[model samples]
Target: MQAVIMAGGKGSRLAALTKDEIPKPMAPFLGKPLLEWQLEQLKRYGIRRVTLVVGHLKEKIISHFGDGSTLGLELDYVEETAPLGTAGAFPLLLPKIESEHFLLLFGDIRFDIDLARMERFFLEKRAECLLFAHPNAHPYDSDLIVTDGENRVTGFDSKHNVRTGWQDNLVNAGIYILSRDMLRRVPEVKKTDFEKEILAPMAAAGEAIYAYRSPEYVKDVGTVDRIRAAEEEWRSGFPAKRNLEFPQRAVFLDRDGVINRYNGFVRTPEELELLPCAAEGLRQLNSSAYLAIVVSNQPVVARGETSEAELETIFNKMKTLLGREGAFVDDVFYCPHHPDSGFPGEVKELKIDCDCRKPKTGMLRRAAERYHLDLSACYLVGDTTGDIQCGKNAGVRTVLVKTGEAGRDGKYAVTPDLVADDLAAAATKILEEQ
Candidate 1:
C-alpha cells in the first residue's frame, strides 16, 4: 500500500532543541536523522509509494530524500504553501493517491503497530475509513475517537454519549487508511482537519469509519525534552517491533529505592523521604522527550500494612515534591501484590500474579497506552531483577542502579540491560549512546 507521511508544521514547542531552524520531524536522535528512521519503517512495511506532504522546510525535506530511489520506494512530494491542518494536506496530495485504499501517517509520530493487521481489519470490516484507536492516556493531548462494538466510529471525547453502550473511549492514532472516495469529503477550495471536520460527522451518520485497536508503542517527538527521551530509549536497548523508527524513551523508576528511601512499606507521607537527585533526574526525564514514569510493586497496601488512601497520600506527597522542584512525573503506576507473602489485605490483593506489577509490563503498558509510547523505545531504571524483567516484558531497556536497594546481588538480583552507579550516572548514560 502507499503511505502518506505528513512532514509539515513548524515545531515551535521544540525550539529549545531545534533552535529556530527545523520542524519536530527533522529533529536529530541516535546519531541518525529522525525522519530517516521513519522512512525505514515504511520500507519494512512493504509500502511501495511514499508521499511526504511538505511545508515549512520543504527544501530541506526535498534535499534529504532526493526522489526516494535508494530507499526502494517511489517518492512523491506535495508542498503546501501555507500551514494546512492535517486533513488539509490531503487535497494537496490527492493527485498522488492512486488506489482504493492507502495509508496516512503523521510524521511527528513514531510508533510500532501491526500495520498488516490494521489493513486486514479495514478489508475485513469493509470500511471506507479505518482509524487506528489506542486506549487513551491523555484525552486532551489529541482528538479522541470513540467507536461502537461493531467497530464503527462513534463520538469524540467531547459530548460522547456514554449511554449508547458504545466503547466511546480510544484516541485517534493519527494514522489512517481511507478509500480514495473519502477524499471527496475534502472541500475543493478550503482546508480541513479530518478529526475536527470530517471523520466525526461521517461517523455520526454511520459512515464506514472505524477503528482497529492495538496496544502500540509510540511517541510524539514534538518537544525538545521528548526528543531527549527518545534518544534515551534508543540507547537503553529495550526490545520492540523492528518496523518502527521513531525514538521512544522513558524513565521507569523504583518506588522505594529511587523515589524514596527504602523504608519498610512506605505507606504514609511521613514515612516517605524525597531523594535529592531523584527529582533532578525526573525533571530531566520529563523535560526531555521521554515519558517519565514510576513502576513499582507496593505490596504493603495489599498486605493490610497500608491502605490505598495511604498509597495515594504517599504519591501525592511525591507529586507535590517533584512539582516544587520543577520536575514532573508524567505518570506513576504500582502493583500491590506479593507473590507468596499472603500477609492479609496486602497479602490477598498482592498475592495473585498479574502482568502490571514490577517484573511484568502491566504498569508500563498502562503508560504506553496513555502516551502512545513505543515500548522498545522506553527504558526502566530499578534496583532488582523484577525491574529488568519488567523492562524486558514491555520490550523496553532496563538499567540497574547500585546506590540504593538494588545494590547487593542475591536471588532477586537481575542483570539489567545497562547498569549505573546512581541516578545521575543513569541520566548521564541516558544522554550517551550505547
Candidate 2:
C-alpha cells in the first residue's frame, strides 16, 4: 500500500512550538518531527511509499527527510507553489499514486490505527472514499458525518448549522482512504475545500462513500495544549493500545433504564430523556482504558410502537445529550425483536425468540466479534436482572445499578458481580477495581 500526506499547513495556532521556523508538519512532537512520526507509522503498517505534499516551509521538510531512506521507506515530495487548499494538490500527484486505493492523512494529527482492518472494510464496501470516523468528546461543535447502518455516508451535518434535531457523534477524524479514481475526479483542483467541494458532492451524487468507525486514538495536535496532552497519552501507551489490532476491553451498558429515564417504552425521541448520572458515568468510561459501548433492547420496534427511524432518533438524542456533557459512547448495538406475537400493532416477522434479547448473550458476543474484544475482560452495566443474566451468559463481569428498575424486574435469579447506587457510582467502582 501507499500513502499521501498533506503537510502544507502554516499552523499559526502552534507558532509557540514551531517558532515560525518550520511548517506545522515539521513541528517537534515528543522529540521527533510530526511528519516523521506519521511516516514511521505508515512504514510500520507496510505502506513503504509515501508522497508528501508540501507548501509552507517546504525546504525545512526536504532538508530533514530527503528521500526517506533513513526511515527505510521511499519518499517523494510535491511542492505547491501557491495555496491550493486541501484537495487542490491531488491533481499534481496523479502519477505518484499508482495503487487502486491509497491512504490519505492530514499532517497535524497523530493517530495509531489498524490499517489492515480498515483496508478490509474499504475493499468489502468497494468504496470510492473511506473516511476514518469516530465518536468525539464534543459533537456539539464538530462537523459530523451522517452514515447509514451499513456505514454508507448519507450527508454531512456541519457544526455551524443550527442543529435543532438530535445527532449521532460520528465525526470525521481527518484521516481517509481514497481510491485512485478519486484523484481523477478532481478535475483541475483549485483551492478546494475537501469536505465542502469534494466529499460532500460525491456523497450527494450517491457514490459509495463509507465511514469506517472505530474506537481508536486519533487527535489533531494543532494546539500546544493538545500536543502536551498527546505527549502524555503517548508516554502512557494509550494510542497503540487503542488499535483495533489488539483485543479491546469495553463496558457494555444497557440504554433505557441506565442511560435514559425508563418510563415504559420510549416511543419517540421526545420521550427519551437522559438520566442525570448517565453522562457522568459515560465520561468516566471514556477516560478509562475501557471502550464505552451500549447494548440496548428496544422492543418498541418489534411492538410497532416505534419505527427503526424513530428509534435511531431516540439514540441520536441519547448520544447528543451525552456529547453535550463531554461524554460519548464508542458504539451502540440494539435488538429490536420481541418474542410474543399476540400484540395488535406488533410486526409479526420480528416477533420471534431472538438470541439478542435480554438474558441472552447475542449482542455482547456480536460486539466482541466486531471489535476484537475480550469478553472475559469486559463488564456489563445495567439496571435489571436480565442484564446481569446476560452478562453472566457472556462470561463478563456485571454491575447492577440502583437506578430505574434496580434489578427488581424479577425475571432472573442472578446476582451482579457488583452493585452501585447509580451509573456514576458504578463507573467509579469499575475504575477502582481496575
lDDT of each: 0.71, 0.92
Regions of model 1 farther than 4 Å from truth = 139-142, 158-169, 237-434
Instruction: Estimate candidate 1's alpha-carbon lDDT, on a 0 to 1 scale.
Output: 0.71
- Lowest summed lDDT across 10 adjacent residues in model 2 is found at 184-193
**After superposition on all CA atoms, what RMSD does each candidate show versus the true structure?**
9.7, 0.9
RMSD of 2: 0.9
Q: lDDT score, residue 167, model 2?
A: 94
- Tens-place lDDT per residue, model 1, 246-318, is 4355677876777677755686678888767777776666545566777878877667777765776677677
Q: Relative to the unseen true structure, what is the C-alpha lDDT of residue 90 in candidate 1, on a scale of 0 to 100? A: 67
- Whole-model lDDT, model 2: 0.92
Error of 2 at 4 (Å): 0.2
